[model samples]
Target: MPPSLVTIGHATFQSQTLGDLQSGSLNIFLPGLNLGLHAAPTKQWVIVLAGSIKVYLQNNQSEANTAFVSSGTSGILLVVDTKDVSPVGHITETIEQTALLFMPTANGTVPEHRVLHNHVCAGEDLL
Candidate 1:
């Protein structure tokens, strides 16, 4: 059987202080799927909410990727350096919308941090 899924919204914060905070929903394809995190010659951070997702670091043989994260869950802070030019794998929700946060490490940096939060939405709080 397929794995179950859930959804949740997160707290609010100033975009200027937190790099670039933008809220949005995502549709994920299930069954051994991959959410590609392309290399951009900079550092990045990502979080997962709603459904279960598996993170895989490319080019690194020493350490393995992260495990599956369930609903109302949060992922570890990912630090992708510029030297590594591989896609980070992640499995997202298939039916529900996942609120994500993507931000650049520094000014004019290519690779940026992508964060996902797990919190239910109220209707009026979708900014």
Candidate 2:
């Protein structure tokens, strides 16, 4: 199945200070031999912090296609859909052992730390 394109944009929020917004979490996936196939666990943002990754996606009627994302030196962000209409997706391979940051949406209840500048931060960091 071919992949469908969704509108995305990179917006900057001008805040005096980073305040408590919503419940969110961070996760880092280390460079593995292979990431394999799977769908997003939740509606979240996948940030490529380092290396490169190719996302494979397809709908019920289209052929799967590839989307390449890399951090270069800084990073790249991808907003993924975990809703019912989300296309079936997975990571076919990592060109450079990718590092991913997953931040769930505010509407989700992922039992994550939601406080800003708190003693405990919720998320996973893998090397």
The model with the greatest lDDT is 2
Tens-digit lDDT string for candidate 1 (1-127): 1123433466543331234333323434454554555453345444454444544344232223334444442342344434444354332322334443334455434333333432222223222
For residue 38, give model 2's deviation from the true position in Å: 1.5
Indicate the worst ten consecutive residues by lDDT in candidate 1: 118-127
TM-score of 2: 0.50
- TM-scores of all predicted structures: 0.36, 0.50
Task: Please list the residue runs of candidate 1 whose C-alpha ends up more than 4 Å from where it truly belongs after superposition.
Answer: 1-31, 36-42, 59-66, 71-73, 84-99, 108-127
Among all windows of ten consecutive residues in candidate 2, which has the lowest summed lDDT? 118-127
